[model samples]
Target: MKQRAITGLFFIIVMIGSNLLGSYVFSVFYLLLSLFCLLEFYKLVKQGGMQPERFTGALAGVTLFFFFAANCYFPAYKYIILLPILLSFIPIGELYKKSEAPFTNIGFTYLGLLMAVVPFMFFHAMAFTRGDGVFNFHVPLGFLIMLWSNDTGAYLVGSKFGRNKLFERHSPKKSWEGFIGGILICAFAAYILSNFYTEYNRFDWIIMSLIISNFGTMGDLVESMFKRSLNVKDSGGILPGHGGLLDRFDGLLMAAPIVYAYLYLISN
Candidate 1:
């Protein structure tokens, strides 16, 4: 418990610091994080008897992140097309290797991209598009705020009020009551954030928070299911008591891209 508390505090500080440091630091820091999460995903998949092209996949994930980030800032970097060309190495390299389940390896390679890469790219994109070309910490910071609030609220509410299991097969501890409590808490947080941010109104922030809460729960469940299939308790021990990058950021994985879409829709 001490370890968990310490790790969580440290992570929160670094996250806040990164946001304050502006776009470059945030992008570089999270790109490294994306790479770590991608590597962790490969490690977990390997334990499940598939040999994903970790190097190629990590490279591709990293490149894809930079590709979108560059496109966001430059808006003229046609080099973005090079990402798919780079990812082609996954299958092309697999063809040369002597593996019984080459296609399975290839599948996991792309799965890493879908699960971790693109969402991170979406997050990077969000950090840049605040309408002034300056780094807007609100979108990404608000995301963290919403995500953390949901986790905290769900835990507190579920421990006292949990009765019906949300998904007993995948996550027995999760409850529908907890989920509802989380959404309410996130909506409340969004309302508070709206006062401070003011770029987006209260209702939009609440809607964004709702999207994060709903999809964030799905992300957690999906990671839980992924681990169940792999027969692992935690993703990795990289963060001491917090499991791994994938475990910590699972909410962001599914939530980021969809939230990006929602924000785009409302903005337009």
Candidate 2:
């Protein structure tokens, strides 16, 4: 328990610190994070007997992130068009590997990018969502706060009063009671943030909370389904009690893109 607490504290510090530092720190921090997480995903896929192009996939994912970062920073640069061209090499390179499941390899490689990289790119872009290329930490920080609130609420509420299974097939431990509790708590966090970030009204925060709670839970279930399919226990043991980067950021994987879209639509 102590180890878990320490690790969790350090994790939050690093995450929040990078965000508070500035755009450069945030970009570099998440870029490396996305890369490592992508590598971890490929490792798990390989463990499942599929040969994903780890090197090419990681490189593609990192390059895709850089494209997004550069676009966010420069906005006037036309360099983003190179991403698709780079991604096309994944399959072309796979032709030489002589793997029996060449298509499977290519598919999982792209899946890794989708699952591990793209969502984070959206998240990092949230810092510059205003179209001014100026970075603000409020949205990203609020997003994290709400996510943490949901997790904490779900765990406490579910552990104590959970009766009905939320998804017994994939995650038997999850409960509908816990799910509701999470949303309520997450909504409360958003409400609090609304007071400080008066730029967006309370309604926007509430809506984002709902998105994060529901989709974040879905992400957790999806990861659980994935690990179950592989007959694995945890994604990885990098964190003392938290499993891995994928396990920690699984919620962000599904929630960030949707929230970014919401923010973008409303901002424009």
Candidate 3:
């Protein structure tokens, strides 16, 4: 218990440091993290008897990361067009494969790539937006805080007050009590942080909090589904007492994209 607590504190410190460094450096870090996660995801899929082209999938993942990053740095060209073009190849590549589970492998790999990279890219883009230089740190930092709040709240509340299962089949340990606790804590954090954002209205912060809370839970469930399907406990053993990069950022993966879309819709 002591070891886990200390490890968790260290993880939080590193994440805070990364966010303080702003978007460009953080994007580079995220790209590398996504690459590692893609490898782990592919390895798990392969272990499950699926024959995905690991190298091809990895290359595609890297290419997709750059496409999104390009869009971030060069938003004027609307380089976002590259995303669909790269994504379209998933099915096309499956057609050339002689493997029995080509479609499933292709679909899973593509979905995993989107799940891993798109949100990180969106967060980066949000950070680099014009006239929002200082606010850049807040965008990613907000996400990290909300996600960590959900995770910590859920575990602490669920352990003490849990009764009704949230998802009995997929995640037996998750409970309604924990879910509500996480959402409430996240919403409160969002409320407190709203004072820091002079540009956004109260409604925006409230809505953002709601989105993060719900989608963050969905992200956790998504990863849980993957692990359940593969009959594995954790994604990887890279982070001490924290599982892996994927495990740490699962909630952020889902939350970031939703937050980006929210900002994009409101700003445009």
**Candidate with maximal TM-score:** 2
User: Whose lDDT is higher: candidate 2's or candidate 3's?
Assistant: 2
Across 1-268, the per-residue lDDT of candidate 2 in tens digits comes to 9999999999999889988998898999999999999999999999999999888898899888988888887863577677788888999999789798999999999999999999899999888889888889999989999999999999999999999999999999999999999999999999999999876899999999999999999999998999999899888999998898999998998999999999999999
Least accurate stretch of 10 residues (summed lDDT) in model 3? 127-136
The list of candidate 1 runs beyond 4 A from truth reads none
Better of 1 and 2 by lDDT: 2
Instruction: Supply candidate 1's per-residue lDDT for 139.
Output: 89
lDDT of 2 at 251: 95
What digit string (tens of lDDT, one per residue) describes model 3 on residues 1-268?
7877888889888878877876666777777877888888887777778876666667778877777665565543466566577667767777888888777887777766776666666766666554333336776677677777777788899999999999888889999999999888877887877888656777787788788878888888988998889888888888778787778778867778878888888877
Lowest summed lDDT over 10 consecutive residues: which window, candidate 2? Answer: 75-84
lDDT of 2: 0.92
Pairs in steric clash, model 1: none
**Per-residue lDDT of candidate 1, residues 55-138 (tens digit):** 999889988888777666667467877877898889999988999999999999999989977778888777766544567888
What TM-score do all the candidates reach, one by one?
0.97, 0.98, 0.87
**Prediction RMSDs, each to the true structure:** 1.1, 1.0, 2.7
lDDT per model vs. reference: 0.88, 0.92, 0.77
Pick by TM-score: 1 or 3, better one: 1
What TM-score would you give candidate 3 relative to the actual structure? Answer: 0.87
Q: Rank the candidates by TM-score, best first.
A: 2, 1, 3
